[model samples]
Target chain A: MTLELKDVSLRFGADTHIYPTSLTLDPGSFNILLGTTLAGKTTLMKLMAGLEKPTRGEVWFSGRNVTGVSVRSRNVSMVYQQFINYPNLTVYENIASPLRVARIAEAEIRKKVESLAELLKLSPMLERRPGELSGGQQQRTALARALAKDSDLVLLDEPLANLDFKLREELRDELPRLFADRDCIVVYATTEPTEALLFGGNTACLHEGRIAQFGPTGEIYRAPKDLVSAQVFSDPPINTVTVTKRGGEFRLADMAAWAAIGEFANIADGDYTLGVRPHHVSPLARGENPVGIDGKVLVAELSGSESIIHFTMHGATWVSQSHGIHPFEVGSQAKLYADMSRAMLFDKNGTRVAA
Target chain B: MNNKTINHAAWIFVLPVVALVAFNAIIPLMTVVNYSVQETFGDNTFFWAGVIWFEEVLHSSRFHDALLRQLAFTFTILAIEVPLGVAIALAMPRKGAWVSVCLVTMALPLLIPWNVVGAMWNIFALPDIGLLGRGLNALGFDYNFTRQPGDAWFTLILMDVWHWTSLVVLLAYAGLVSIPDAYYQAAKIDGAGSFAIFRFIQLPKLKRVLTIAVLLRFMDSFMIYTEPFVLTGGGPGNSTTLLSIDLVKIALGQFDLGPAAAMSLIYFLIILLLSWVFYTLMMRSEAQ
Candidate 1:
């Protein structure tokens, strides 16, 4: 089903949980709600599922105003972050509960439950109770239950957040294919930018109960509309420096000037915030025509194939992520360079300045 | 992890409780065991009985009748109270200022002394002037609890239910409130009706509390004495004479201490066995 929110907002007593926001979810598409904690992702999903009534505005599902409809009347299924299954029921019974509620025939319930268990890799543990299974298996039972309902919309609220890193990685790779051919709108909420990127769907970036940007996931990651979107969408955090823009030249902290790229010619000369991702900022002499800066290394952390270097320059601490091992001792001086063509600029109001 | 040296002196702290139990429970129980195995008469003179009292009480028709009545009463109350309590708990408001109000009201019945509860029901169900009795008679029913055996049983069961169902309600309410909201939300999204929600979520969650409620009520009702003794005095032709009342009559009223002590031991054993069975069954299902 196509789900649309027309200027929906939610207020809990004196605190506003969600500002007025409108979004339309295409049917049978995977949609990702990406944000940090307390960014109103769960609230938005709850409103869409009819679990909470919006304080104002309407919720439309396929042209019907369902803002006041009860959750039981809506054809939707939700899996919570905490593994939630009927504790007294076996895994097979948990997956079959919804079908039983609908009074489906016994044969159909068995078939559907078995298929979902196979898909989620829970078939071997179907007879075991929820408490007896591992956390990942329990969450997979919850997922299978949600899938067996065959509802029009499936809402997952950070369903894999509680699992360990190895299990999370495994499930993250399998989720897209699990829901690939289902004729339902799948909405997944996550705080991990990498998970959102891997899901490869439409993403709505939220910040402090407001939608900062919403578009195709890859496009939004590549070109965020504002500084907040960039900060929310980046994992290691984008590197930013206050710079003054003069005609054809950009001065950093009034210390050094660099010729502006041809794409930035139309920007009027004024103060602007320059943002460069850590991957684009690296050790000097590594890239052609790179902008160089001097800094004292504060900390260096090497993990797997990359090293994250924390350094202080121009009275501000900045991070540089470089490939391979680059052992820069603390308090040691090092030269860093940033690829000018990959840098982003924002105005004083935090809006991105288009190239 | 903090590694600390173990102190053997911790046993000293528990000595007071051990002494209290020895005085209160062990001494009294030993006295009853002594009485059961020997015959006692005036001046504290004792003679060896060698389980004769146990044989007499076990073979007596009076003991059989009292045991049957006790079982009937216990099972009846369990049947009525468990479901009724859960229903009332489900109907209670989950939040707001009214929750405390409901709780306080439910606790009122439990706070009254057992004798006072029996006396109050006795006066309230008097057929001549009591409201319930007069009202039922006026509505064209012969409802005289003091004169008829069936009416006496009816009034006795009703009094016990009114006095004790609140305990079950409180326990079930506690169980209901501890369930997280996510379960309800998931049930709703799964298109479950109210009955389905209760069957799948609320009932399963309440299993532990209900087990506790059932076991406590069973033990309490089995040893019920004061209330019925105060209300009917096991009268109306001994219709409401439960085992505890019968035991008291044997030990105190007629001073037949031998049979009474034997019956008391048997009573304790029965309660222990039944409660063990109940707890084991409940915990076993929960483990699964």
Candidate 2:
């Protein structure tokens, strides 16, 4: 559980340039690195796992400098995105291989493989080879095999990303509990925010090469520290509408709040965009507030219990979410105003202007 | 697709192959079985011999000698070739342009026709004009395969190794290339030594291909007649007269088809039974 990266960097091509300039993984907790595709998430995992060494920096495991240590010396297990199951071996044999190669006692190998198979619900198909199993079954068998290695550090490079939604959720929920007995540190990398929140022990938001933010999941999601972090937090990509102050009036497309928008009080308002989560936006009832926008409902898309309504603003779109089966037709005349207390203000350069 | 319709189409596809193989192999096989149990001195004439040739072969000094030679050659080739092929295959680059180059280079010896292989080695191993023989002689070794029985056997085994090691190399190399990087990573985590990596990962994974390589090498080595016959011509004495060479000496050279036919049947049966045993053992291991 004492894995550490002292200035670890990984370079993909011969450019001798690193993808992530510098990054560190927290030990003994599920640290999820959330980033977009090609953000070098898997590269970070590979560097940590010792499959490929970092071109520039040293990797330390258990306080020992493992810079020159080969992958066999690293004592890390990785579950790749693709199921790297041994095709020649049965589910039972695949799990038993690390033990068999280690020359463990025959009875112990059998007992361990059997119990792990049972835990993975693969007991019925233990005798079948990986080629015969379904994708989910094969993935679990692979997972079981990695678990059986009993390595202290587990680096999963989006293990559940390929599965269907139901299966992904099932495995995602079962992951923390599955490794509870071992206490092996897990570094789970995924781009999906829901998965990031699910693994919400310690989250590192990666942008380009550098970690934009590294802190507890709740703190990062709640504050976001910047516009990019806020954008990464919510779905339908956290809507932003430009808010400007002309003299004493706060104007935002045919809407003016008397006196002020409280969160917008301290910010210089020549240029500003209000960032609002879709779930937090609400339709303003007539006479409820003077600070309301007159706009046409551009598109209303209903998804189960909630509906997302896009309000056309000047040169921008403000998306408002109506909870509990509220359906609005497109092009309907609607009054839109987000609760000023719930919105965040961002200036140009896409950085949040602190209030 | 009804079962009957599906099955009828399958029989139509399989019938030609089955009939052709039966005509080529089964009819000849039945004839050999017929000859093994009886005596045939001339065309269409037979008499009950009641395992007489089998008795003669089992007791014959010549059969004993030929078998000893064949057994030595086959086992010797297997012992040297499997590990040597594996070593060369291991040294090959895992991927990229170099892999294709190395692969094609390894395939060169295999592509050379068998008789030409013998001819090349025969001239190469000759003491006067050949580079290898002259080099060895200059280095203080009196090398002569033409006159000495031991020298003939040594040259024949060496020739066989050169001619056929590529097959083993190709098979072992294919198996080696197929192993994914995950196993190596897992082995790394296990702190396995080089020998342990080879024993536990490389060897076990290469089992199926090695089985093919071993069975092929064994069968080819046992039935070897061309290269050694062309190179040694049975030998300066009797050192390199394998069962195939001896059988030909009887059947084609001496026109003793009676004993030769009996000998050929015995040789074929021995190969079939040995191949069956190897196939069974390999399949059983895989099943477990």
The number of the candidate with the highest TM-score is: 1
Instruction: Give, for candidate 2 chain A, the lowest lDDT window spanning 10 residues.
Output: A284-293
DockQ, all models:
0.59, 0.22
Q: Which segments of model 1 are wrong by more than 4 Å?
A: A12-15, A63-70, A100-108, A236-266, A269-344, B1-17
Docking class of 1: medium
What is the iRMS for every candidate structure? 1.0, 3.4
Q: Which runs of model 2 end up more than 4 angstroms from their true locations? A: A1-7, A12-17, A24-27, A35-39, A49-51, A58-66, A69-153, A159-171, A178-185, A206-212, A219-355, B1-15, B27-55
Writing each residue's lDDT as its tens digit, candidate 2 over A1-355 gives: 4777767776656653335345455456777878777666777777777767888878777678887677766667778777776666678888987787667998999899999988888999999988678778888988898888887888787889878889888888888888776667788888888788877777777766656777788888888877877876666678877777665556665655544546555566587777878666666432223346666888888788777788776666778776666667788877765666666777787777766
- Fnat of each prediction, in sequence: 0.76, 0.37
lDDT scores in order: 0.92, 0.79
Q: Look at candidate 2 and tell me the lDDT of residue A348.
A: 81
Candidate 1 lDDT by residue in tens digits, B1-288: 879988989999999999999999999999999999999999999999999999999999999999999999999999999999999999999999999999999999999999999999999999888999998999999999989989999999999999999999999999999999899999888887789789989999999999999999999999999999998989788888999999998999999888999999998998899889989998998887
> Model 2: which residue pairs collide?
A72-B188, A72-B189
Residue A103, candidate 2: Cα error in Å is 12
